[model samples]
Target chain A: MEKMTLSSKTREAQSPTEQWMRYLGFPGGILLFLLILYLPAGAGLSAGAQAGAASFALALVWWVTEPFPTYVTSLVLMFLLLVTRTSNAKAIMDVLGMEVIWLNLLAFILASMLVKTRLAKRMALWLVVRFGHKASWALLAFLVLQLVLAPLIPATAARCVMTLPLMIVVATIYGSTEATPNNFGKNMMLLNLACISVLSSITMTGSSANLIAVGLIQNMGGQRVYYMDWMRVGAPVAILTMVLMWILGQKLLFRMKPEEQVPQVEGGLELVKKQYELMGPLGFQEKKAIAIFGLVLFLWMTDIFHMRWFGVEISAPFAALLGAVIVLFPRWGILSWAEADIPWHLLIFSAGAYAGGLALDDTGAAEWGVRMLFGGMNLKGVPFGFTYTVVISVMMYSHLLTTSKTVRTLIMLPIIITLAKALGWSPMSLALPAALCIDWVVGLPISGKPNVIMFSTNQYSVGDNFKYGILTCTIGVVILVISGATWFHWLGITPSFWAVAP
Target chain B: MKTLRLTAFILLASVLAMAVDLPTYTVRLQAAPDGSGQGIATIALAGCTPGTFNLPLGFTAVQDLRVEEPASGIRLESSERNGMTQLKVTLPPDIPAKATLKVSFRLKQVFQIVKLKPGEKSTLPATSRTFKHAFVNTQEYLIGAYRVEFLFPDGLMAQAIREQLPKPAKNEVGPRVLLSKVDGHQAAILQFNKLQQGDDTSMIVELVPTRRSFGWLIAGLLLGGLYLFKFKDLVATKQP
Candidate 1:
């Protein structure tokens, strides 16, 4: 009784750190407001720099503390960008205005409905009964599905958001002994799903960042990497890597005997069936969710080939907003008045990230960074082909600091380009290194959006991620560096290892 | 042996720092009424050297300098400094597309020796700045600005004008980038924007420090600073 009373009293008194953290969320917003005001007017250093810095701090807070709703922070970031004039006000508010976001919205809505109705569990068990005789083969099928779909779907978060539910279903079927998945096999299975989707995105159409790289490369007057050519290289690399990942999984993590008897579960199957049946008739909400999802995909896939045919120049963002609108339609039920189901805070964080990159441009913060890089190399690494290796290695390791691939790409690509040419070398050397190297990050759910969404399933942990991710990335970087070197000479595309003359 | 080597190094360094004069000569021409298209550009070099010089194929040797020709392809083969070398070639009035008049670049070495001394400075007049895609904003820094300069004989009446081009503006000294024919001489300097930044001809700066060992640290830190400013926030989450 004394202990209970003591615990109750303790609950009534908050700790110092916790108390400070609670206020950290809102004060952070106001601190940024002050910082924005201090920036010099024309260049936007004071405001833009503050925005980038503030957004970064805010993101750290949200990621660690979870003080505010993720979507609200996303919205807060958008508001910050809007209020500070960091980005086009319209663009900032309507960032989700892209079609790809809609596809994601539609996809997520459907996935949510499927899970909420227990249809996902039913599907998982059904598939396991049909295919679980070989665990690796079942996992391979899931891996292949993600790879094929990633190019079409640009947003990793949306893809992971949809696929996480399915992954959980697989985890349930594979039958780990522990109630919580502290097992090696289950943990690796979760990571394999993410790694495959993340790596396969080398094609111009694969991810938004890839497209941005291609566009930037084209602008450089270099020959464009045709869609087919990109696929030729990307598809093979992805498939080979997938096989390698499977081998690693089986040998190091799984190590199950071939004769390990699979349980022929009559009761388990029956229970799943009964539970699915108890969910009863498909409600209006469930039917509407699937239909809205279908509509979203229809809009999303317009770019599969005939994009111009429909006069669709709208970016992936607007398409997302349009698809999200379906949620508001009277017939298809979704979040009520106060519950938009959007992670506004996370969006704000993303906007703030965007603002930060913009600030780098406006304040010449990026230029300042570039100056710092080549300031030392000026005397020794001349004729710059030698310096190329040094720059590539630095950029590769930069992933250790951040997981937002877009932010890294946005900030580094130009500075590296400028620095290379200054050293009497061509900018072409930086492209492959930039696109292929940033994927070196694979450690935690907080590391990539897909990893985060995968984490939302609450299955994997830090240890699981660190074990496979670090090793995989280390191997991945080494292979890519070699491949890049080989391809550099083989393609004979740039002036390096060769020269242009009259 | 060591003292000899040190003396040699000091001598070479001092020579590089000072002006070494080459031999010079003078040949004057009176425009005699028939010299309607004739002109001359000379300077005062107290101690300067004039070396091998010649006017090659593209230039029409105009002893009289009275013809009006049409050739923009003409380039000066012989670069004879005025005060440094006195026998100046006659220049054409209008150099047209096909006409072999005079301009410069892509000329073979010519042979002419006139004067020598060791103290006067014959200006080594050439400068180039890298034109590259350095800006981090839109990938379009190439379509911006370019500046070039040309020096003539008379410092007082000297004017720089550009013509027969796309976009022209007021240069600091010359007509910005667009120069039309001035005083009917085929001599001029031209500048235009490269197609885009990051193009093959784009200028990039390599901050090469003078000290050999220190340059690497400077470059690494520079690259790190850039990587940080540009990407510090991204990896900020990964930080402890």
Candidate 2:
């Protein structure tokens, strides 16, 4: 009961900005909504699109400000979408039934399996024993782990589920809890979050959005972006940006003092090592948990071959569901229904955010918004370097406004291709580089699936997230700009910056 | 018996599929000098049977509708339902599999007129009034390549314009989109490879009258001559 009370108190605790936002956020959202709604519509912007944009603006304000709980704000946004005629009733409600939400739900159950079976504790102890001497090394170790898993597990949420328990356990050992989080915990959790998102851009098969981009480039641009071609360009930019983010995060953003850098446990590294030794060999439950997770990972890794081998593809959600069913099976499974740790609030928040985003998409607001964005630019005779920089920046930062990477790709790539055709520049020159930046959805908790999962840990505030996220994004933009001028020019992905189209 | 039923179903499905095999669908919209317009849709169908097929003209309130299948010599009896023209084509039993259908109709309004008042706006003088011609594909299917040609009346200059995303603070700018010339008229052509059901493919362009440019030139010359006449003494005093 005391523990429950402490956790609840932690939930209620808000930062100074959060407190002020909650106070003013409600009226502020309404004012922004009215301002955008009644403003003179731009070209090609229908009334429906205007209303959709207004509704999305209000939701974003409320979400950032926490006028209510984030989930309640979502509920309000969903209602606003309906009443404003931005989206239909069925569409608003159907967001909960989306496959991403289902994947998150089932993933939480699998996450519970790892934690409940003591398997997570074992792995956490092992990680701590190996790299827990300093918090920086421990963070780097998880970073490496994410890089290794990014190519293997195409589903980012699945990777987060597998690693979330380890993060939590290791965080507690470093003296960070849900009730009381320290810089070590904040840096650890947010770094892993950045890694999962940024590393996905390193490979062509990193995410489904990457594949969609490839298809768009091939069909619309008539040029194919081979897997190796993507990795050749994508790997260097993503890796260098991640490393810079890691160093800057610790040294600058969420700085850890010398005392905080070391393990805060009573006995430190030796104690963590002893604890791992004390756990002894893998027990029945650990082995069972491993077997289940191993099978799930195998299925995830072999998704490309599922159609050829099994005649049907088991998507990420279904594969996780399969594992969840076994994990909850009668007496044989590792966890029971009561022991499963699923956060319905985050799921509701996710659903509402998605509903709001889809409303923007369905009402043609998103497309109109992108069109107006490019239409306003005077890139007629601009140098290729300047144009490339603007395009890459827009693509990298657009994740802040969108919820789904696939929707973003669908809307963005065509306009980009069209813009390339309008200009004399090659379509692949702009669209390919833009496609490489699709997975940089690391700006907010509502930005991506793994972000929501990581946010639910309550280790960091939204302010911390925005600061770290925006900084990381800026770093990524800078690296891409530099690379586009140098490395990409050498790679033939980009032509000379001063060269005019023939 | 099950196999026979399946075979029959497959054959019927194939025949129905061939009924709407629109390999080449072209729509040409011609805007006359009097703010009125006409639309001609030419569709090429392959392996079609004798049946009634409804073709949507994407305009509500159409006038003088005509439909003809040239190859099969089938005259269509038409009626309007749900904003589409349902044509009942009666083909002979020995008709060929391929056919070409042509439908022509007059439209209510093709362009919205924007008259420019002299000296009303500071930046752009009363040079030309633009007519905005917009075409939206209202069909609920993926149009592989929607070839639309907008032919303005002769001596009117046309430039296809594209709307940009919204900027709250900045002034509006309609960037010029690439257009092809069809018989000396600016033709706004769009390809809808990713168009989905209920999704609109809009092509917007601004048509300026060439005579207005000449009018502006005459006005400028008269103004310059008047200025010289009115300020001759002042100009001579200042010139020394």
Candidate 3:
């Protein structure tokens, strides 16, 4: 069994061709942008819309290839849009200040507080102590942590950041180091990446992408989707898929040895318990963090109550910002501004992507694209069942083209809503299912923020993630389709095949 | 007796034919704060004899109705038929070949706040409420340049605008005073130049954040102070 290690040497040893390809990605993106902009004026899109499309293509390329830092590409995208005059500066800045961006920022601050107070470590240790006797149980414990935190955290990247330290500790405890990796480390890290990305779709506020989709849906004149309604449709799919992921990881992909299955060291449990002891009892800061987080969770869950009675709507971002403010307040707060570990790069990237997306909508590029592609196809006459299958399939595989889930949601939901409107079908039926597939961005290492973060662990290679990811993604698609046809059909979200003439 | 009956039938047939040949009516409505408005509609009747003409006013109550004709005092009468108010006005018997009849009315328009989600049904106190959009039903006529002006309460500012139609031709933000009240407010006016007959329109105007959210800032500061004093070590120590 080979142990896992985080070595910088491995990353520096890229082949000459790989390096050249990385450098070529930027110009390639620029060329694609120009090609789209120079398309025949008769293509039926306004010049501004064409410019928006060009910038979007360029950003997608840069995000996937990482010729520069992902954040730098985001900056480049903003600069390009400004130079092209696709949208004004004020409009682009507004996109940056949207509630979705605020939610992510506040969640990052809260995550930093959790890490600083060592509360995250304490919780992780308690779970390890209870379930660390066996490798399978430890994996299940991590999965359970993700499931519990999914609804409350709101940011998949933040959840992954909080859980990564625990995962590394667990991997180390299992005799898995960088130099000598084992099946246990590989399965654990890969599963971590998958669970973090997939489970986010289970709640409306689980990720920024979900919120973006909801906002677009509401903006398009669809019925406002409530929190409970999202959970009712998403929880079953999420829970079932997570269980299947565990089974696939343990049984099919990585078979474990007897020694690896249990604690490899005689005093493995002792080491974890001693670490827990070193932290001592819960400090006042830990208690305060818990209290604030609890309040935030309560507000997020019961937003409907406030909205109905007080006529006050406390959005997820507002709730998270409340908690963060409480945690970082001077003298009373647990952390200072300097202590907070917010990832500005991710925020910048998201802001630029959002700006491009808004331009796509405001300039009518997405709508035009949809009309041009599907206008003459007469998709309205197609059976609803077939259309549902096709939309779900396209949404599932779309991760191959773009890396950011926010960008994917921005590009796809509007088009799907437009298509649904044209076809005389319910927008929610298409948009909701497509939105659920937002977090299936596990096909490549750079597919999602969490995936990128997990890749830094170096416990698993890109091939390991792709091989497992593709299989599970296929399984997920099947599960989603079957659910849409059967379970969701019973729930009236999708039309049953029996009801159709096909 | 047969000749008298034929004369009566001829007169009735002539009136029916004139009704069928009446030209289309075009109206321009301006919505104000507090959901009240006024509109002026022009009915063209070239090359046709003048008679009593009926115009339907969707579902709004008209406070006053009149016909604007020079040197003519034409009385206007209104009645409810099939859940709609129909305004009847009489034109001169010797109307010219290219004359236009203008009808105007003060509207006490009441728009329903569109409920997009199930949880939005509960009644709340007026002070804490913020409505995103209102729906106006315009299924009565082929409206031309139908405009709506949303006046937000004092201290509220417009943030964003969304409409179901292919983006509004003219969406401008300005200042306005609340109707029947002394409070000043911001106004967002959205214009739709042409609306197909029997189609309804909806608009959502998002508002800037109110001062109520400042409570969160204060709470955060208090909590931060308490943590800094009680658990200084935890705050000072950085995690690995």
Candidate 4:
């Protein structure tokens, strides 16, 4: 139902009904948030708890349909949750403090600074110059830049935000409207670049979901999946899937040829230099924020090596909040807390996510869902492969239906374990692959955090995102199924604990 | 008058959607006597524990239970009394010592599914057990004075040997013995002389507790709002 770009429908601006929806959504959202946040506070409240959880559906629905900023809605919900004594401020906040949410905000701020300084644009310009004039080569370079940037910037929306202007730059230099071959080449280079950049986030560092999983895993108090350790397994799988995505995109996408001459941007880097000059004499606080960000990265990197000495450790969320305070308080300078303006929606959605997960637990709906899918296998005597295939396929298909990657993982992991236990089949056959492949689920533009942020800009249409996403997810799913399992099997590395036990 | 009526209608609709009340009903179990020094027959629901309802009730469940040295003649019973439907169980005579039975049920009225939007779905999914999917703890069910009957072959008379028959050896697929009626057309029902485990068996039956849908209207509103907001992006074709 969503069209090509996010703003495809919003460009003309608000309508009468929209005005009413906005007003209604705000107060109504507050009311709904209250309902969701409260109502289950007393004892013997299973139904109430479940209803409280299910009411979150209304929050998302209202946010999407109404005129209010979604993040503001998130803030409202958080306050209500605490105010109603639905959960302690500490407990609700713990979910917000989960690494993924903070990492996303930190990354957004950094990307914002980069955009403000024109640093991202200059880099894009330099990149285009270095890998010039050849369709395949340009696409390849774009792919490389995306892969490199994804790790540094976990927010897909941030990447699109920082680089979209550059894309427009390239598209303008080549083809502003429709394209001839050269324009088509730039088109291929830029659009595919955006798509691949989004695709690259399947790895933990590149996206919020992976970090969320790591947080949950750590919170679950078992294997402390280090940033680098996650990268250890995640990087290779992500890279392989990305490479395959490029080949498929070029083959399935277009036949445009590269141009002969490169864009002469001898003077483009000046904008960044001018920005630094215009902003002038960076203050102690700016320097401090930068220092803290650096320290956070250092801690994130070193955490894996000395998980003991350096471990007990710092998370990206705490680090970002620390940076925000340092920038706001220390030796007043270029930036202040006012500038940080951390979007509360990120935290709100994260809380909603936490609450949604609780509801699934409360209702036993998730188990009921998967059991129905696999229930007949033990009775109807379905073939083991069919059973595995059905389970695996369902895991893959779930991406199309839902956007939250962790929710899919939560649902899939338990079902796979339960089904494997029932059918005497190996669990890794489902678990390992789903974890490795969950990021590859690109069916809709909004499937992951990056996709959600990308949609916010309205540069690309929903249809475009859906089309591109479905393409990558399909290709990525097949590649992971074959290469991922084969590679893991060959290395004698089990994808899951159950597989080893099974 | 029209405005008042409209407001009242709206208020009533909202109430119906949001209201939830405590469910009233009690779980009741039934039994009989059997031979091989014991007696047995199927346990049937005599009726609701208290006041009945007009509500439709039936349970469906599948479970894994293992019974040892079991003599058949066990029956799980379900029926209606007054206006409400009831759930009950019947046992067979001469249930060998240590015999056990496993039963699971899934209910229809209690089963529910509603569509969700991207924003509404949760990361930690719900663990749903269908009413048809539940576990019964038999060892927990057997206790004193609660008569469990075992149905024996040849319809024989009272043998103090009844207490001598080992508690129905748990043969799980619902404690086994072909559950055939012994003589006197009387199926030997095993009366629990004394429960090996606890007599109070707590079995959780999952039912569809809530039914509500919200995603579609939201999607419609989002699209409609977006369409209205970006009128320029959506151009009209002229009908020449």
In candidate 4, what are the lDDT values of residues A236-331, reduced to their tens digit? 656766676566555655434333233423343354245335554555544544565565555544444545775565554555555445444546
What's model 1's TM-score?
Answer: 0.51
lDDT of 3 by residue, A8-79 (tens): 323321345545445555566766776776564322344556667888887877665455655677788888
> Which pairs of residues collide in candidate 2?
A371-B164, A371-B165, A372-B164, A372-B165, A373-B165
Q: For each candidate in turn, give its C-alpha RMSD to the true structure in angstroms.
A: 19.5, 16.0, 16.3, 19.0
Candidate 3's DockQ:
0.02
> In model 4, which regions exceed 4 Å deviation?
A1-103, A132-139, A145-237, A250-292, A303-312, A329-333, A336-367, A376-388, A484-502, B1-240
Q: Write model 4 residue lDDT over B1-240, tens digit each, in one string.
A: 999999999866643433111122122121122101211112222211221112112223212222222324434444554433333433333322232333333222332244567778642225332211111223222223332222222212111111122323221111111112333332323222333432321222222113223552464457555555664322333357
Candidate 2 lDDT by residue in tens digits, A1-502: 0011112122443455555555566667776777786575443544455667888898888777664677887888888888665677898899999998999899889888888778888888888888877788889999899999999998888898789888888888888878778888899889999999899999989999999888877777778889899999899888888888888889999888787787677987888888889889999998999999998889999999999999999999989989999999998998889888788888888998899888776656776677768878988878888888888888888888888899899878877876776778888889888998899998998889998878877888777899999998898888888888888889888888887665
Instruction: Rate residue A227 of model 2 by lDDT.
Output: 87
lDDT of 3 at B179: 15
| Candidate No. with top TM-score | 2
- What TM value does chain B of candidate 1 have? 0.18
DockQ of each: 0.02, 0.02, 0.02, 0.02
TM-score pick, better of 1 and 3? 3
Q: Candidate 2 at residue B230, lDDT?
A: 56
lDDT of 1: 0.43
